[model samples]
Target: MDYVFGFIGAGNMATAIIKGLVGNSVVEPDKICVCDVDMDKAQHLSTEIGIEVVSEAEKLAEMCHIIVLAVKPQNYAEVLEQIKGTMTEEKVIVSIAAGISINYVREQLGMKCPVVRVMPNTPLLLGKGATAICPSENVSTRDFGIVKSMFSLNGTAEVVEEKHMNSIISVNGSSPAYIYMFAKAVVEYAKSQGIDENTALKLFCATLEGSAAMLMESGDDPDTLIGKVCSKGGTTIEAVNKLNENNFCETIKEAMDACTKRAEELGK
Candidate 1:
């Protein structure tokens, strides 16, 4: 119960989760550790977040109660090989590497290692992340709860079936990029109309935030809300007409489908 968390990668997502844990008092700063091949990156995070940076992967794995594999999917094999010596029954491995599965981690470790697969979005950096986690069959319920709570320290964490993890990747994990694209388009359009770039950005960003709040607070459905804004023959209707003409809905569907397809491919 020291709740020490060790991150193998000192990347942005790992940095976000580490800050969240400390900000929310889930784990003390001194107990968190990071070890990366890039010593500079490790040292930066250590100094920036007040976390310990260990030079050796084995030391990080041996000292921490929970090990978070936060590196890219391609680097998992290398980190797996490096940490293999530190694998123990008491250690729990939680991976946020995209497209990696619980079974893959167990196979990499060459043991019935308790593993949790997590897909977390970039919004976690802002303390509003949405994360979906699925655990290996070897993980006990208590162990799973500890893992889930660790993520919940920064954002909404839910336990889901592993089969659906790929699908959820489209729903939330990569959805932020799609949303950002939409917002960027909106901001650009405003600039095209001769509005100040900063003003347009503020307006469009606020509009997005307000729309999300309305979706959560209003009892009515989304289509109903759209209809409310698009009153018969209004400016909103004109924009909606153009969007429909451009096949906006189908475009989004296609993009999301592509994301899910890639996720499926990566897991294989």
Candidate 2:
């Protein structure tokens, strides 16, 4: 609660998290510091968000108690190497780099400093993100809770074992793209059927929002919900039958499998 948060990257995810913390009044804007190779990007956040901008990653690491490694996976080595010397067991490392595991952070740092690995989706930019928090053994319970609460303030945050982090990529991290692709197809189909493009997009997007709410609030299983939409011999059932005939479910499963596989590969 009374910690200086430092972000090692000024990218979108970092900006989103930083904004969430400051916007929600969870952390004071002045208590946050950010460093990025691109000073323009870091200055943008500082100028707009009223956070401090550090010239170097190590300076941010030295200044903040909770340091977020929001850099890209490929840049993790350089950033970690740059800041690892400044890191101590008292300081917490929160990593948002996809496919980078907790052990990887520890190994790269060559220390037993507390590490929390988080997988957060882009929806966090809109404060509707899904995040999975996985802390290393060295992380204290209190520190883990702080990390979890910080993410929860931004969106839905759940604790998950390290082993499941990669698999979670398919569930929440990469799911937005899947939903968008499905929406695109539906909107395109509607447009081809003489519906206005913007109207079709708006209606389909609203349908998606409403359907998600129904799944969460209606307390009905997906199959039951499908049944609700599909009457005994109705047009909805015809469409459902067509989807089933075309192995829609199987295709989704395969896509998820591919996503999980790539996540695993990236981790390695």
lDDT of each: 0.86, 0.88
RMSD of 1: 1.8
What is candidate 2's lDDT per residue for 1-268, written digit by digit as tens?
A: 3337999999999999888888888779999999999999999999999999899988788889899988878888889999987888789999887789888888888988889999999999888899998988888888787788778988899989999998888899999999999988998898889999999888888898999999999999999999999998889999999999999999998998898888777667
Q: By TM-score, how accurate is candidate 2? A: 0.95
Q: For residues 1-268, what per-residue lDDT tens digits would candidate 1 score against the true structure?
A: 3437898888889898888878877778998999899999999998998998889887789888889998888888888898999788678899887688888888888888888899999898888889999988778888787778767877799888998988889888999998989888888888899999899988888998899889989988999999989888689999999999999999999988888888777766
Please, what is the TM-score per model?
0.93, 0.95
Worst 10-residue stretch by lDDT in candidate 2?
A: 1-10
Clashes of 2: 0
Q: How does model 1 score by TM-score?
A: 0.93
Give one clash count per candidate, in the order shown: 0, 0
